[model samples]
Structures are given as structure tokens and as C-alpha cells.
Target chain A: MLSDLYIPGASALHRMRPAWKLALLFLYCTALFVVSHSLMLGLGLLLIALGYGIAGLRPRHAFDAVRPALYVLVIIFAAQLWLEDLAMAAFVTLRLIALLMAAALVTYTTKASEFTDGILALLSRAPKWLPKDKIALAISLVWRFIPMIRDQFEEVREAQRARGIERSLLALVAPLVVRVLKSADEIAEAIEARSLD
Target chain B: MTTRDIVLIALFAALTAVMAVFPPVTLPLLPVPITAQSLGIMLAGGILGAKRGALSIILLLVLVAIGLPLLSGGRGGLSVFFGPTAGFLAGWVAAAFTIGWMTEKFWDGLSFVSATLICVAGGIVVMYALGIPGISLMADVPLSKAFMGSVTFIPGDIVKALIAAAVMVTVKKSYPIIGQAA
Candidate 1:
């Protein structure tokens, strides 16, 4: 599910260089916080939605992209409501949603290979004493492991549910750790066998 | 570090990121949701030792900064770094380092109880110390209110701490990932 967000399309964004897409994301993220007026933020949200459209995405794509963040957004809005006024809540919410949508537009349009390549390129230029290759490998491993772990968690939960036991972290965590460590051992063995180091 | 060290670091870092994918348990009153990622943080510290555990956490944050939706609830990117949750996210690094360092110091003699104590100190106390101020500043809330609100996290974190300790002891008994101090 982690990599499934990128819908394949030949939109101009998909055609743009990965570096340029990343640069645009950076610029938009920075610019949104700098211009925090409600009107500007509202316009930014509209612009980002338009960006999704240009990237051959429908309004539904934008909503789906933003949906995961809705829980956090509601909490922030509620907190702001308690502390400040509706305008402040609205401003913060819009600012966040705009920034998130802009990022998602890039994410949903960019291919995984391009994104990984961009990351590798960026890390290659890091100062000496940092293990850039190792970092890059770790990033790729993160992507690979996310869905695997999600699946493992679901399976563990299902087994526990079938047993009719109470849903508890204690019941779920130990087996998950054992499985994760075993998989890590296998991954390490594979890397060592490949002598990729 | 050898190739083995690098692999362990990467594996634990990936574990931490994967831990975030679990659905969060949200308490209705508190803004912060209870998550299992902090348990992963404590386990990384206890299992991987000090420097390696901290490095793993830094690696995870680096990925988050680069716009991977690796955080719980699929939140990521630099925008999250500037949001109300930034402090807690930053605290992950410190918490991991503190717990790992303590675990390393007492590596041979540490029991599950003491390891759990370290987790609470680092993962809960240190995290709140950083996170409360972060909310007060970033979210524009009062420190008193933020501290009061964050109390809800304590019970959840205590559970995570105990679970992390139990996992570490069990894994050590079985697989023994961390080497003995020379």
C-alpha cells in the first residue's frame, strides 16, 4: 500500500525530472508557511488541487491523498479551536492541507524508481564520514519492509481474533518482534551472500 | 562498523518505520494518538545498543524528511517537521539515544525491570519534555495546557515500555543480536 499511491500517467508532472519535482515540492512547502494568510492559503489549496488535475488526477485523488491526514487535521483543528478562534483553526488547517496536497501531487505522480534515484543522487553529495550507500540501502529497505510489516500485523491480529482473545498489545507484540527479527536475519544473510557491501 | 553492523542498523531502522504503519489508538480527549512506534524505538535502543540505535532513528527521520509517507497515519514530508507533532518526532531520536545509551551502560547486568525503567525515562519523560514545549510553541498553546493534555500518553507509554523490555529480554534469550561488551 505504501507505493501504490503513485498512479501511472504520462502527465507533465510525471514527465518532469525527479530533481525538479523535488525542488518544486521544497519550494511549495517553504512558500506555504511563509505566506500564511487565510486567503493565500485557500488559493494555495486551490492551486494544489489544480496541480493534481494537471497531473491527470481527479478530485478524488486529492481527497484520497489527504484522507490519511484527516485524523491529525481534526485533532489540530480541535486543539486550535480550544486555544484560539475558528479563524486560527481554519488558517492552520488550510495551511496544512495545502502543503499536504502539494506534496501528494508530487508523490502520486512520481514513479518510485525516479524517487529512489533522486534520493540516491541527493545522498551521494553528502559530506564525507557519512555512509551514503548504506543510508540509501536503508531507505530502500524501509520501503520494502513497510507493507511486509503491515501484513504481518494484520495476520497476527487475525490469528488472535480467531482465538477470541482480548485485543492487546501484549498479545500482539512478542510474536511480531520475533517474526521481524527473523526476517531481518534473512535480509542480512541475503545482503551478505550477495557481498553487496 | 562492519557489514554486519550496517545491516543491523538498516534492519532496525526499517523496523521503526514499519512500526508506524500500525493503526493508532486515539483517545478522545487528547490530541495525541497512542502509537506503537515508540515501542519500536525502545526495542531498537535495547537490542541495537547506543550509537547504532540512534543512527537507525536518524535514518528513519531522514526518510520522513524526504517525503516518504512513513509516519503513522501516513503523515510525512518536511511539512510534518513544522507541524504540532514535530517535537514528538524529534524526541524519537533523543529517546532512542538515551534508552540505548543507558542500555549499553548496563548491558550485562540489566534486567527487564530496569530496561522498562529506562524506557519510561527516555521514551516518555524525555519525549514529553521536548514535545510539550514544541506544542506550546508550534501549535500556539499554553505550556500548562500542553502538559496537562499530554498526561494521557503516560499509561500508553508505560505499556509500550514494558512490552519493549519484554521483547528485548526474550530476543536476547533467543537470538542474541547485540554482542557482549568487550
Candidate 2:
């Protein structure tokens, strides 16, 4: 499920260095906060939408990016309208939409490996005692384990359901945690055996 | 940290991410959905102790910042850090740390009541303390209003804390991990 997020493309946004795109994203988000005018925020939203087109991503893709935040945005809009004025509500909503769209564009264009490399480049400047290699390993291991754990969770859920135990939180979680911990111990031993530390 | 420590940190981070994959339990009156992800935070700290527990959350956030769709409802990326709920997300780190520290301190006489108290202190008090201000700042709402909006979440969070406490006590008895390693 995680792997399917990145759309393959050779567009300019895709070709740009991950580090530069990340820096621009930071600047864009900060700039959106600074420019409070509604007109400017609307223009920023338009620009980000156009970015999706330039990246060879469909309009649906752009919508997908902001879809998850739709609930929160709507609630904020209603709250701001109640608390302040219509203009203020529109301003806050538009600003958040623009920020979400811009960030999504970056994710749509960049690959996970490229993002990890850019992060490593940034972390390289940290203190030597930070164990950069170990940090990288830890991040990769997290990526690896996410799907594994999700599958394990599914397996445990199925097993519990078969036992006619539905809607019990403890029944679902306790076995999963026990299995995860047991697997983790084996994983640690395997990593040690390989001298990966 | 030992290799096992690093692995445990990664595993806990993965566990948290997995929790987000479950559909959130939505209530008719509440604006926000109740999520299982916070329960994962409590478990991480109670089982892994202070340092590794906190580190696991940091690692999870780093992945989120890099645009992994790890958060509930498949939301992630740099924008999440700027969202209205960003404060709650940030607070998870401290929440885990507080729970881990307190659990360790109470390890000698840890009980369901004590564990639940620790989870409430960290998961609810500390989380809302940071989260309310974040909503005020980002949504441009008054602090009092922000606090009012968040009141809907307390009952759900308390339930999560109870579940976390039960799970921790059970795990500690069956296969203890916290303070077992340096």
C-alpha cells in the first residue's frame, strides 16, 4: 500500500533534486502563512494546482492529496466563520488547502529512496556521535516492518474473528503485540548475527 | 544503543504506523475521529522505556515528514507538520517520553491503576496542553474556544489509556522488555 504512493514520471518536478524540492516546500509553506491576503492565497492554490498538471499528474491526483484533510479544513472553516468573519474563514481555509496541495505535489513527484538520500545529506551535518548509518538503518527497518506488521495484524484479526471474538480491543491487540515482540527478538538476533550493527 | 534497541525502536514505530491503518472510530457529535494510534504511543513508552520509546516516535515523525502516508486516513508529508493538529503530533514525542519515564520510575510496584494514571497524565494532559495551543495558533481561534473543541476527545482518549494500561501490565508479566537492556 505504501509503495503505490509515488507515481512514475519524467516531468521537471520529478527530475528536480529532492533536496531542492524540500527546501522550496518549506519556503512555500512559510510564505503562505506570511501572506494573509485572500487573493494571494487563492493565486497560490491555483499555482499549486497547475503544478500537478506540469508534473503530469491528473487533477484527481491533486484532489486525492487534499482529500484526507477535507474534514479538518471544513471544520476549521466553520469555526473561523463563527468566531470571526466570512473573509477570515475563507482566508484560513484557502491557506491550508494551498499548503496541503503544495506538499502533496512534492510527494507525488519524489521517490522514497530519493527522499531518504536527501534526508541523509541533511543529517550528515549533525554531530559525529549521532550514528548516521544506524539512523539510516533504523529508518529502512521501519519501512520494512510497516507492511510486515500490517500483515501480521490482519492475520491476528482473522484468527480472532474465527474464534468468534469480535469487537474486543484486548483480544485483537494482545496477541498481535506478543507476536510482534517475539518477532522483534528474532530480528535483533538476526541483525546481530549479520554484524549489521 | 544496542542493535536490539534500534530494532525495537523501529518495530514500535512500525506498530504505531500500523495502528493508523485501522479506520478511526467516528462519533456523531465529535468533529475528530477517535484513533488507535495514540494507544500505540502509550504501549511504546510503557514497554520500551523512556529513551527508546521517545526515539521511536521521532523516527515515525521523520518518516511522516518525508511524505510517507503513515498517518491515519493515509495523511502525511510536510503539510501535516503545519496542520492544525500538528501540535498533537508533536506532543506524541513528549507523551511517550513522559509515559516511559513514569513507567520506569514505577516499575517496582507497577499496577493497572498506576499505569492508567501514567497514560492519562502523558497521553491526555500533556497532549492537550500542547495540542490546544497549536489549534489556537494555526486555526486562528481563541485558546478558550480551542480548549472547548478538544473536550470531545477526552472520553475516547481515556478509554485508550485504560486499554494501554491493561496491555502494558499483561505484557510486563508475560514478556518484559523495559529496563531489560541498556
Candidate 3:
């Protein structure tokens, strides 16, 4: 369920430093809000889509990145359509899609290790006694276990469905918690054994 | 904190991220969709207590800050903070902390009903307190409209709170040490 957007490639975007990619993302997002016209936002979306092409990424990858936000985009579109004009609704939705795709491009190109290393380098400059190692490890593990926990969730969800507790949100809770906590314990023990502390 | 605390924090952070992968239930009237992520936040606090619970969410935010698509609908990056949902994103930390703090203060004598109540107060009440402003400011909507629009989230959130409460109670009964204070 954790859709890691990193599509491995040697594109220029991938070659760029993660920190710089982040800086540019901030710049792009700021630019998105500043440019208010529908035409400009539409052009912005086109420009971003072209960037995906230059990066040797498929248009489908960009679409997949923002796919999960389809519902939210529809909501934003309908909300603006109700509250304002068609032009404004299209402007807002296009901006959101452009922004999501831009961010996704960065994630799709950059490897997790490169991103984490960049983050660690930045965090290393923080004040002393910040528990930099622990924080770094926690962040790394967040990426590592996200996919695993996602798989576990699917397993638990299927089991719940099989037991005919499909509609009861409350019923799914206990087993999911138990499984996660059990894994947490095992992971803690493994950490101790490795003397990572 | 000890190894166990660090590990539990990471695990709960992962849990929070994983919860976002579940497809959100969108109510047409509200901008914010109903997500299981908030339930994970409640569980984090109720099960892990204040310090670790808040720290867990902090770690999750750190991942988001670095542009991991870990939120519901695969959202992340600095831009997300500039979006209408930023307040609710910020509220997750506070919500988790509030539930954890409540559990720490009252969970020694925790009851099924009280646990559910704590989740409601933190998960819904505190979440809205922060989120309404977020939507109002970022989305450029009126505060009154934002508040009214957000009322749709309550029914789903209430169900989530009950689930979180029941999960906590079950965990306490099944594996008591899991929630025992570090």
C-alpha cells in the first residue's frame, strides 16, 4: 500500500542533489500559488509534464503519483465550482495536480538512500544533544517499515473480511494493533542485539 | 528513551503512515475525507502514552517534510504544509499528545467508555480546534464555513475513536506490557 515513488533512473532530476530538488520544489510550489490565471496554471501543468518527459519518466508515472489524490482533486474542483466560477475551479485543481506531480517527480527520481543521506547531512548541523542518530534511524525505519506494515495491513484486512467483519471498523482495530505491536517488540529486540543503541 | 521506546515510536510512526494507505471515505459535503490515519494517531497516543506518542508523530512529520508521500492519497512535501490540510496535519501531533497525556493521567483506572471518550475529545475536538483555522486560512474560506464544512468528519471520526478505544482495551487485555509505561 506504501507506494514508494522512487523509479530508479539516471535522469538529470535524479542526478541532482536531494536538497536542491527540495529547494526547487519549494520554489515551484510558491510559483504555483503566485500565478493565479488559469492559462498560466495550465501552462505550468504542461511544463511539469514536459519535465517528466525530459527525465525519462513516463506520463503514466506522473499520473500514478497523483492518482491517490483524484478524489481530493474532485472535491476541490466541485467545491470551487460551487463557490466560484468554472475558471477558478479549473485553476485550483490544475494547480494541485501540477504541484503533486512536481513533488512526485522528485520522489520518483530520487532514491531513498540519497534522500536520507541528504536529510542526515542537514540534520547533522543541528544543535548538539539532538539525538541525531536516533532521529535518523527513526526516519530511515519509517521508510523501511512502511511497505512492510502496509503488507501486514492487507493481510489483516483480508483476514478480517474472511471473518465477516467487513463493515465493522472497530473489529479490524484489535488485530492490526496486536500484529504491529508484536513486530515492534521483535524489532526492538533485534536493535538491542545489533547494539545500534 | 530506551531501545524499546525508540522502536515503539518508529513502529507507531510506521503505523500512522500505513493507515494513510487505506482508501479514504469522501463525504461530498466536506473537503476533508474520512481517513483511518486519525485512528492510528489516537491509537499511538492511547497505547504509547504522551512522550513516545507525540515523538512518533513528530518522526512521521519529519518524513513528510523531506517529501515522502506518506500521507493519505500519497501527499507530502513542503507544499502540503501550505495547503488547507496543514492544520489537521499539525493537529495530528497535538491530538496524539493529548490522547497520550490523557491516558497517562487516567489510564491506570481506564474503562472502556472513558478510553473511547478520551479518543473523542482528542481525536475530534482537538483536531477540529486546529484544523478549522487551517482550512480557513489556506483555503481562503470563512472560519464559519470551515467549521461547518468540517462537521461532516465527526461521524466517521467518532467511529474511529471507538475503534481506537476498543483496540487499546484489547491490547491491554491481550498483551499488557505493550501499553505499560516506559
What does DockQ give for each predicted structure? 0.40, 0.68, 0.46
| Residue-level lDDT for B56 in candidate 1 | 86
Per-prediction backbone clash count:
0, 0, 0
lDDT of 3 by residue, A13-98 (tens): 87998888888888888877786677777778888978898799987887776676575566666777888888777776777778
User: Order of candidates by DockQ, top first?
Assistant: 2, 3, 1
Give the best candidate by DockQ: 2
Measured as a fraction from 0 to 1, the native contacts recovered by model 1 come to: 0.28
lDDT tens per residue, model 1, B27-75: 5665567787888888888888878888888887876766676777676
Docking class of 2: medium
Worst ten in a row by lDDT for model 2 chain B: B22-31
Candidate 2: tens digits of C-alpha lDDT, residues A18-128: 888888888888777787777778778888977888999997887887788777788789899998899899888778778777887888788777888877887799898
Q: Model 2: how large is the Cα RMSD against the reference? A: 2.0
Model 3 chain B lDDT-worst window of ten: B76-85
Candidate 3, residue A192: how far the Cα is off, in Å? 2.5
Alpha-carbon error at B93 in model 1, in Å?
A: 2.2
Candidate 1 chain A lowest-lDDT run of ten = A164-173
TM-score of each: 0.81, 0.94, 0.82
